[model samples]
Target: MSEFIQEKRQYPRKSLEKTAEVLDNDTGLSLGILEDVSKGGFSILTDQGMRPSETRNVTLVLPGPQGSPHKVSLTAECIWCQTITERADFAAGFALRSIEDQDEVALNYYIRDYQVAGQKAGELEES
Candidate 1:
């Protein structure tokens, strides 16, 4: 028998046209490519594994109003991480813990305007 799983996400997630790059703020190193994002959290596809409950200061490079890249800084806590056997990469989910007012505004704009499922872009349907 198949069991039903309840959805727990507060905000809807939107995938990007080109994967956004996630960076470790402290080290300025590339952490991974942002797979999808929402107001509350985001997920990353990375080469390195992340432990659950781990906290990080990260910057996301997102597509801006006119094809330019905009960076949004925030503190995030890792919620889960799993390995993709075929790709040999890790996919990690993180919840937003903190963000500056300006960064938060920018993130909201990116989600509303540039995302694949966003009104302006309207490229891919939301998953």
Candidate 2:
């Protein structure tokens, strides 16, 4: 029998029209691509494994207004991680810990406009 897990999210996650790439700010390494996002947290599909409770400074490359690429920098804490592929690809969940006011605004705009429910993955609306 499968064990049931309760959903503890404060905000509902939304699927992105286009996946955003997440990078480690300190190392300039590509951590992963964002799979789903919410106001509180997000999940990424990555090749790197992260331990729960680990913290990192990250930059999210988001699709901006007028087709420009906007980068939002923030600190995040890992909530959970699981290996998802035979080649050791992992899916990790992270909670946003800190963000600048301007970056928060940009993130909110990206979540609102770029992530619409029922939109097919990688299908972005024309600007």
Candidate 3:
């Protein structure tokens, strides 16, 4: 196992209010945006849905201030999930994979914005 050094930066995570889509590769399902996201992955809150076990494609459109948004399409896999009592949602962990260098740059840039605003890189989730 290789060690993934967590990027040294501010953890700016904001609760997601906009609607995002998650397209299922096998069943063609679109899981709505739950809440919170980061360059690492996201937390999906749903009534209760089965997720893919294998590595699948996950696309997310992140909206920044000033109507400037960056769309990211990358490969990720469902690692684990759990339902918490505090919130009625499934907090899942996803290992980002096959990310384009440009996408990584964009992710960094997004975080940079937060840093510029004296915040950290977080999207209602963890990075």
Candidate 4:
């Protein structure tokens, strides 16, 4: 029997599926999907495989409160990478290096809003 160890995260991540771009110094731009997000960092599923320990700047186009998309940029370092067998995409975990105050607020709002909505839905289903 094998036991898997769970990593403790500083912030809880909420599932979010949104298109984003990774700005690579050598490769220019790489497209990826933002799978889950938190105020601290987010996971990206990309066609290009990012080596572990690689760092890059990512720009996330996230939906705003008014329904318009807003751009948030952050420097991130890849913690781990794994190839998805069934798909061509590679899943990568990124740790956010730095973020602006406004960007942090926006990210927190998006995560909390989703969590609240999900909880409400679950309650409705149970009722």
Candidate 5:
């Protein structure tokens, strides 16, 4: 049985259109690109049929916000996976798998920025 783990912070991330591969245990099955990201979770858009309630090993290679490509590999299980018939994109939301210490630091910084910006925006909205 696989254990579910969540991160401390949820980052607000942008859409990353890069090649991403999803692995089940030690076997490679399908590939997709990361759609949107956050520290707590992320959504992937893929045409392949992957079970949501199962654990998976995912490796995502994307260009970081600085415009350099960075690879992040982690173990994640699909909390919710669905196929969108009305829309062209299918989304799969997964918990943070296992966020590494280094990645957590980066994610914390990103999440902090996201929270600050959101707070500022909310304040502005009231104005």
Candidate 6:
């Protein structure tokens, strides 16, 4: 028998697996991948590990429906970091600290768009 872990999140998360840039708000040099995102926070996969409570600026470059590019930036604080077993990669969870209104709109739209697309795909698969 297999057991699955239950999620305990306030908002639904969308898997992105998209490249993202993480910048240290103070030094302006950080890098990672935007693994998943929710309205309140996101998980980043990186080669480096971060300590809990550390903060950084995350910027996601999402492609628009018309192929144009959209960028959303937000301030986030690291909540937890765990190393991937047998790999050099680490996955870190972050809580959004601050986001401008425009950015928030963009982020919400991006997440909802992906969620809808994913649902449609699932429906197609089940059909």
Off by over 4 Å in 4: 2-4, 17-30, 115-127
Q: What ranking emerges by TM-score with the best candidate at the front?
A: 1, 2, 6, 4, 5, 3
Estimate, for each residue in 1-127, the C-alpha lDDT of model 6 and write its tens digit.
6598777777877765344455555566666767778889988778988999998776766666666768788899899999995534899999999999999998887776663334554332210
Candidate 2 residue pairs that clash: none
**Stronger candidate by TM-score (3 vs 4):** 4
- What TM-score fits each model? 0.86, 0.84, 0.57, 0.75, 0.58, 0.76
Q: Write the per-residue lDDT of candidate 3 for residues 12-32, one digit (tens) a residue.
A: 344555555455445556554
Instruction: Give the whole-model CA lDDT for all candidates, comma-separated.
Output: 0.86, 0.84, 0.58, 0.69, 0.58, 0.74
Task: Give the best candidate by TM-score.
Answer: 1
lDDT for 24 (candidate 1): 100
Model with the higher TM-score, candidate 2 or 4: 2
Clash pairs of candidate 5?
10-40, 11-39
Which prediction has more favorable lDDT, 2 or 5? 2
Error of 4 at 2 (Å): 5.0
Number of colliding residue pairs in each model? 0, 0, 14, 0, 2, 0
Query: Arrange candidates by lDDT, highest first: which order?
Result: 1, 2, 6, 4, 3, 5
Model 3, position 30: C-alpha lDDT score: 56
Which residue ranges in model 3 land beyond 4 Å of their true spot?
Answer: 1-29, 51-53, 84-89, 115-127
Candidate achieving higher lDDT, 1 or 2: 1
Give the poorly placed runs of model 2, Cα more than 4 Å off. Answer: 1-4, 86-88, 120-127
Tell me model 5's lDDT, rounded to 2 decimals: 0.58
lDDT (Cα, tens digit) per residue for candidate 1, span 61-116: 98766678899999999999999866439999999999999999888877766547
Give one digit per residue, the lDDT tens place, for model 2 in 32-111: 99887877889999998899999989999877777788999999999999989753399999999999999998887777
**Lowest summed lDDT window (length 10), candidate 5:** 118-127
